[model samples]
Target: MNGFAATLASQLTSALPATAPLIKAALRADPGLLNNCVSLTRQLERLVYEPFQAIMKGDLLKETISKGPFDIVIDGLDECEDKQGVEEFIDHLLDFFQEHPRIPLRIFIASQVEQHICERLEDDRVQLCNLDSHSPYDDIKKFLQVSFCTAAKRDRVIRAYIQEHGEWPMKPDMDMLTEQTGGSFLLASTIFKYTIQPATAEDPTTPMDRLPFALRMNGR
Candidate 1:
């Protein structure tokens, strides 16, 4: 309906604002023409995709956007009103690239694991990847280090302490923090937050005091 058409049209306009008039002309010729999901996809291909690709073939690519490829992030697929529409859109998208799969574009769909959605994506053509498959130890360590640096800048005490001492997190401290994370980014963030929390009179513990205790932490 209007949802899919509007969404696609917005993206198209964002990518190529010069085509807004053409899009409006097409809509004016046929009112609510893209109300159907299939029509929306087809018209989008005609009005947006084909023309864009055609322009890209010539020297016009430089006048438009970056020649480099980019990913389209489509989130909340499970929230679509028309479940059937979702299936058809996916089918059409995959079929569109059946012959030429090297198009400089990607679609990243973020959706809750619903039966219908899962069934549609479960195909040889689609490459499915999950966050659980990736090891986030290095990323988590980098985030922790950056977060501490930011916090230290805001707090004078921390800045003074760091200036007097070297880096707040030495090799041993970083190692303990990384080990305590146990490969869970959420746990790592939570521990970092707890460590950096303002020290009260009742429980006056600085990040330095709390960070070392991570070495003694137990239970995964």
Candidate 2:
């Protein structure tokens, strides 16, 4: 959590350079507060929340609000190894928003529906969206198209196949591959890499040969 807090502080500094002075002032108030020894909540208060609050309440409030409503994206929170830390971090996050409801900031966390995360973030303050309800077929199709095009440019095997075979993976192949992924971004990316990765001595199959194989794997 402290590592996450430090990264957030760095990103905040980069995104809003004008707030650096205030953030630095907060850090100065408590020396070594950015270090790992400090609690995540304390690092957040001194480095992020306090500076953010100061800016929102300061003389330049109108100017900031004019540019208003910033977002902080926290992705793959469920992948964190420390379960207790994750729970504590979520608690701290919700408490911050609850205490300062007027702050013009929004945190968007994208993670699988793990019980610990869901239990904390199911608050009225947070709006939830289930990605499974929405089909990602079109997005996956576009990704495969762009990925194949880019690979064809850099990969001699794909280039040769495209030159000989007209489009390496035609509309029918694309539709099949897209369907095989079943709206999964991970599967889409995995198969893309599997298809285009350079062949080795042990696995000397060319990318031209791998497309059919990838399609065969389906969602496995």
Q: Which candidate is the best by TM-score?
A: 2
Model 1 Cα lDDT, one tens digit per residue, 1-220 = 3457567767877876765776776678767656653465676575655544544544555533455664668889898877777887787777766755766567789888888889988988888888676887889789888988898998777788889997887877877787788887788878878778888998898777887676566426
Best by lDDT: 2
User: Model 1: residues >4 Å from true position, as ranges?
Assistant: 1-68, 74-82, 99-102, 110-115, 122-124, 153-155, 198-206, 213-219
Clashes of 2: 0
Q: lDDT of each structure? A: 0.73, 0.85
Weakest 10 consecutive residues of candidate 1 by summed lDDT: 55-64
TM-score of 2: 0.68
Model 1 shows how many backbone clashes?
A: 0
| Model 1 / residue 204 / CA error / Å | 6.1
For residues 1-220, write the lDDT of model 2, one tens digit per residue: 6577778888988987767998778778777887777788787877888877766766566766788778999999999977888898888988998898878898989999899899988889889999888889999999999999999999888888788879878999999999999788899999999998999999999987888899897773
